[model samples]
Target: MSTMQPILRSLPRLPAPNLWQSKFKGSRARGHLRVSVMTEDAADAAVKDMQISDHPQRSIIEIFPGPGQLTRSMVMAGAKKVITVESGETFQESLKALEQNSEGRIQHFAMNPLSDPFDEILLPEHTAIPGLKPQSWDKVHEDVMIVGSIPNSATGERVLHELLTASIQRMGVFRMGRVEMYMFCYKDAVQRLIAAPGMPPRNRVTLLAEAAAEITPLVRPGAAHFHLPYDYQLLRLVPHEKPKIETSVDVMDFCLRSLFTNKSHALNKVIKYERAHAIGSEFLGHPLLGPGAEILLGRLSFDHNIKVKHMTLDQLNEVALKFEQWPLRPTVLYDDMIMYESRRKR
Candidate 1:
C-alpha cells in the first residue's frame, strides 16, 4: 500500500453524519447551509485536484473543516501545516485527535469566519508559525492560502461579499498581504461573481470581485463526492498584487450599491434617481466626465445613455474614483452605525 494510505487510515473517523444535521439544525432548516461529508476518497481527490503538494511550505487555513477530513487529506498530501478554523463545537474533539496524531502539523481553532474578528485569530503572536508571516501590502503572500466550502445560501453570498470587501480594503487576513483563496461556492453565485459586463447577473458583487482579484472556476459540481451537491463549484480567487479600485471601501461600496440599485436604468438616470448629484452641483462637468472626455461620465468617453449593468469593470471603477476625488464629496459616504464596533479603531 502507498505510504499515504496508512496515514489516512490512522486519522479519526468523522462523527455520524446525522450529528451534522443536528449541529446545523437552524441553518439547514432555513435552507441556508448544506453539509457535505466528503468520503476519504473524495477528500483525497479534492486535495489532489487543488495541487496542495506543489506548495508544501504554504500554510493552509481550512474554514469549517468538519472533523478534519479535508484537513487530513491536506496533511497527507504534503501540506506541512494545517490550521483548522471550525465554529461549531461538533467536531472539536475529532480535530483535536487529528492534531495529536499529526505531530504538531495540524492546529485547530474555534472561530467563525463570517462574524468573528479575524484580527483576534491572526494575531501577531501567531505569525511565528511557519508560512503565517505577513508580507508587504503591495505583494501577494505566496505562503498563505485559504480553503473553505461556502454554504449555498444568502449567508454564503454574504461571506464572499465580506471577504471581497476586506481584500479591497486590505483588512483582516488581507492585512498580511493578498492571500489566495479557494472556495466551493454555489454554482449560481460563482456565475454572478465572474460575470462580465452586460451579463444577466452583472452587478455590484461582480464589479468589486473582478476589480479585487482574478477569479476562475477550477472544478465543476458533480457526483464524485458523497453528499456533494450538484449546484456547487470550486473557485480560485487570487487577489491582484494591487487592486484596480483605489478608492476607499466605503466610497466604492456606496457608488456601486447606488448605481446597481436600478441596474436596468440608464447610467445618468440611475445617478439622478439616487440623488448622487448632492455630492457636487458640477458633477457632470467633472474632468473625468467633461464634454472633451472620450467616456464623458468618467475618464473613458462613453455615451451618457449607457445602462448601469452594461458598464465594464474599468468604467465602474472610474466612476467610483471620480466620486472619491470630487471636491464637494461628502466627508462620510456611509453611516458609522453600519460599521462593526471592532473595526472602528482601524
Candidate 2:
C-alpha cells in the first residue's frame, strides 16, 4: 500500500514560521473555557459510542483533509462511511485514504468549500448515512465526523465567520447533529471564534490543541533527553482515549550472537509484527523542530524567570511551552512535562 509520507507531500506546507506566531492569544489565557467546550463534537462522539455501540447510520465529511490515516483507521475499525473533501487537484486522495481506513468510514470530495462549488460536491446518496445526515440528528449519536487542516492563509475575520457557518453546514448535513471538526488549526482563529464580540455562546468552540499541558517520558529515541531543547506540551482538545501509545521494541532477547545483535534487526522486527499503521511517520507540529516555536517560548521563560510549583500538572504545562520558546521539537513538550513532574518528586 502507498504510505502517509507520499500523501502528505502532496499538500502545501504552511508558510515560513514567522506567521505562526500569535497562536494562543485567546484560549491560552481563558481558563474558564472547557476542555469539552473546545471539542464538544469529539466528546459527543465518545458519548455516542457509549450510548450506541452500533453507529451504523452515520456518514462523515472532512474538508481539506490531510493524511487521514488515524480517523480512517478509527472509522474502518467501526465507523460508517466517511466523506472527505479537498480543494486541490490531488487525484483519488480520498479513495487511496479509504484503503488505510479501518471501517471504510471515509470518502473524498474535491470542491472549494468557499464557493458554490461546495454545493455540487455533496452526494445525493450521503443523505442516508446513519448518524451523518441532518434530518436524523436527534435520533442518532455522534455518527457524523468532519476534520481537516485549516489553510494558514485564512484571515482572522474569514476564519471566524467560516467556522460558524461551516459548523452549521456540517450539522445540517449529517445525522450527527452538530458534527465536530478537528483541525491542525491556527490559534488565532480559535481565539477569534470564542472571543470575537457578538459571537454566539453555545457555538463558541474550544481550543482542542496547542502548545500547553505537559507530560513526560513522552519522547522518542528516549536517550536523547538532554539533547532535546525547547518548551513543549501535549495540549489537546480531548484527553486521549488510549492514554499511552508505545512504539518501542526491545533490543535483543532470544538468540543474539554477532549478526542478531544489530539495532537494525530490532527495527526490522518492529516493522514486521507490529501494526503496519504505526510504522508511518508520527507528525507533531512542534515549535522546536519547526520554525520559531523554540526561540519564542524559550526566551519567554528566561524573560519571566519562570518557575514551577509542586510540579502540578498545570505548572508542568507552563514549562513545556517555555521549552518551546527555547530550542527543541514541539512533540518533546510531552516529555518535558513528564520530566518536570519527575524533578518535582525530588
Candidate 3:
C-alpha cells in the first residue's frame, strides 16, 4: 500500500470530464452538475488536511470518484485499502488503470453507491466477496473512513441522508468501525450540520446529525481550495465517544420529526397537541416515560412561546433522555396534530 511518490504524482494523467460531457443519463441533465477537483495539487492538499498520514492502517471507501482526481490522491496517500462504488461506467478506463496500478489494493464495484446498502458492500458474509472480514454488530473499529463529494441535487441529498442514516443506525460499513466521513457538500448542508439552537433553518436534519455524531468543519464555504462558482464545504463527522442520551435511532427520528413539523410553533403548543391525543396519551404511559416524565406536563412560565428551533443541543438531549424512559415504544404515525387542534377550536 506504500507509494514512493506523492499520491497524485503516482497517478497517470486522465481527462477530467465536465457534467455535460458525461454519458450517464443522470449527469447529462441540467442542475445535476458534479463538482470535481480538477488538479492533483488540490486533491493532495485535501487529503493532507484530513491528516490520515499518521494512521497508515486506515482504509477508505470512496463514493463516485469521478475522474479519479481524489481517488489518485487517496491511493498515493497510502490508504491500506481503497474501495470505491461508482455507478457510471464512463470513467471505467481511468478507474481500471488505477485498480491495476494499486496491485489489488483498490477494489472497484460498478454499483450505485446510493441505491446499494453498505452492509452488502462492507461485510464479507453479507457479500460473497472473498478475502473480506465479517464485521460484528457489537464490535467497533475506527480504521474505516468514508471520503468523497456528492452532486448538488435532490438525489445527492437523498444519498447523503442514506449515509447518515446508516451511521446513526450503525449498520454495515459503520458497524465495521467508528466510521469517519470526509465529504464535500453544499455550504447550506454544512450550515445545517453546525446550526446552533435558536438559529435560523434549524430542522430535522440538524437534530439528527447533532444527536448522532460530532460534526466539525474542515473547510468553510467560499474557500480558495475549490474551483467551483458556488460555495462548497468540507466537513468531518464521527459518532460521539459517549452519547449524551441513550435511546434508539427510531425514537429520535420519530420524536424529532413529529415535533419539528411546524418549526415555528411554540414548544408548549407542540407538546400539548402531541400528548393530548390518543397516541400521545399511550406514549406517555410507556415505561420509558420515567417517574419524572410528569414534570414535562407543566409548561414553564418563561419562554412559553419557545419553538423547537430555539432549543439548544443540551435541551434537545434532555428531551430525548426523558422520552427514552418510556417503557413501551410507539410506532411512528404521521398525523396533523395541528389540524386536530384547529378542528377542536372550530
Q: Tell me the tens digit of each residue's lDDT in model 2 across 121-155.
A: 45465442432234343332244544443443433
Q: lDDT for model 1, on a 0 to 1 scale?
A: 0.69
114-149: candidate 3 lDDT, tens digit per residue: 775466676555332334443443433435678878
lDDT of each: 0.69, 0.32, 0.63
Best by lDDT: 1
TM-score head-to-head 2 vs 3, winner? 3
Worst 10 residues of 1 by lDDT: 285-294
Q: Give the distance in Å from residue 215's predicted Cα in candidate 1 to where it truly belongs.
A: 1.0
Q: Of the pair 1 and 2, which is ahead by lDDT?
A: 1
Cα shift from native, residue 150, model 1 (Å): 1.3
Local accuracy of candidate 1 as per-residue lDDT tens digits, 1-346: 1132223335556655445444433344444464443556667767877788777667778776766777887888877578888776666777888888886778888777677446776675665243365787666576778888777676777788888888887888787788888887777888899887888888788888987888978765363443433356678898988788867777777778767755777787555433323233233312212222223255445675889889987777777787677666556555532342224236
Q: Where does model 1 exceed 4 Å of error?
A: 1-9, 15-26, 124-131, 136-140, 221-230, 275-300, 336-346
| Cα lDDT for residue 323, candidate 3 | 62
